[model samples]
Target: MQGYILQIQKIKDEDCIVYILTNSSLVKSYRFYGARHSKITQGYKLDFELEHSMTFLPRLVNTMHLGHRWLINRDKLFLWQQFIRLFYEHLKELNDVEEIYFNVLEECALKLDKQNAKRLFIEAYAKILDAEGRLHNCDFCFLCDYEIGDKVALARGFLPSHEHCMNQNGFDKDEIEEFFKTKKSLNLSDETVNRLYNILLDGF
Candidate 1:
């Protein structure tokens, strides 16, 4: 999907950032200035030039939508919450989960060990869950003939029930690469990665 370009500048107060967004022919603005010694209850309006772009998905985004109404509706927060829960459950099963995962991702310019493989796979899963307009996770397993401890392999980033399930619910290779690049950009450290992984695994 083509991402919205955010142009940011410091506000006159020097505490907040004024962000201007441009997409296609649309221009929009928002202001974010953190309060001193406390949190801010901010207000925002997404002023896009075209009202429809504010609601409609582009072609690539539609593909990622995965035909899930839970994702299609903005008020259905459970869809995201459930996916986050599942992600943590899977992470708990890995031995060197965090250290092997985030540390290797932070150092993606270099090659990694076999331990890094599963972490890398899970990271991709987490990111597809994080994308702005899609519910990529839970789609396959929820309706498939697979169990939690099942060893699944991914084709084009889709974690199908098995290799046989690849053609029916697989993602494209480009989708996998996109998730990898996006997760690596987060630059999460080994410790923080482990902490989050453990928290999720522990069902927090």
Candidate 2:
């Protein structure tokens, strides 16, 4: 199967535990390091085979790195690694995850070099929430269960609350509402994108 290496944990003697995000699931595989084996880096896409082992995790072998033009750009690559790391945290505990998670990463990766990383990150995260049926209508304040005012403080998953309720500055009601509906960060300022990105880091 083809997958993106989300994270690699080094074990004894350079062996490692690799967490991969594939089309249908998050899979963990073990790699036995050897001089003949190519090093695997996080964020690299690979076409690989899994060798089932009786005493260990599935063995990763015969790997071929899928070439993406963005890989050569260090700045873009760093952003990709940082943004993709969030998926490991968000999905690590889940047993059943929708295929949209992988699709979101694939779509975002294809556009990373063409668009602002913060904007792409926000949009991709919103897509994840939408697919999970957690992206709610941001009309009422989740805290008070009342209709919100001109400002809304969005929690980790864009759960809207009145600014007074959250005791923090809120986003403009109309703008945030549009963002929720469209899942597009193009209309939002970079500052707003950064805020949403930080909230995304909190979790899925």
Candidate 3:
């Protein structure tokens, strides 16, 4: 199956725990280190086989790295690392992560670049929230439950609130509403995009 390497934990000499995000689930597979073993690292999209065992962790076998051209650029590589780290952190508690989640990561990996990484990251995150039914879908403040006027501050998980109530600066409520509806942030400024991304960093 095709998957992205989310994390790698070194164990004893040459052995490690590999946490990979497959299309439908998050899997922890054991890697027996050897020169002939497949080269793998975080943020790598790989095609590999897993040998399941009742007595131990699944074995990662016959791995082939895929679509690694993006890593040739250090800037894009850094962005990809940050993106995958977010996934690794957010999905740690879950056994079966959704396919949509994997797709979001894949989409970002396929489209991310030095110039548009931030925008694409924000867009992908917005799509993820929408897929999980967590995207805020109200015209009122999530905190005070009051109708929001022109300006609305967004909290972690994109929870909306009146600017005064949240004590945070934010974008126009109507534009944010449009962003929610269309899943596009093209018109948003770099500063606004950074604010939105910061909210995501506060967690899923």
Which candidate number maximizes TM-score? 2
* Cα misplacement distance, residue 158 of candidate 1 (Å): 4.3
Instruction: Score residue 153 of candidate 3 by CA lDDT.
Output: 87
Steric clashes per prediction: 1, 0, 0
Candidate 3 weakest lDDT stretch, 10 residues: 109-118
- Give per-residue CA lDDT, model 3, range 35-128, as digits (tens): 8886788999889999999999999999999875668888878877887888899897778978898888877777764348777888888898
Clashing pairs in 2: none
TM-score of candidate 2 versus the correct structure, residues matched by position? 0.93
TM-score on alpha carbons, each prediction: 0.21, 0.93, 0.92
Candidate lDDT (C-alpha), each:
0.33, 0.85, 0.84
Give one digit per residue, the lDDT tens place, for model 1 in 95-125. Answer: 2333332332233212222234324434544
Tens-place lDDT digits, model 2, residues 9-91: 99988999998899888889999999999988998888999999899899999988987888899888887888778888888
Candidate 3: the clashing residue pairs are: none
Predicted structure 3, TM vs. truth: 0.92
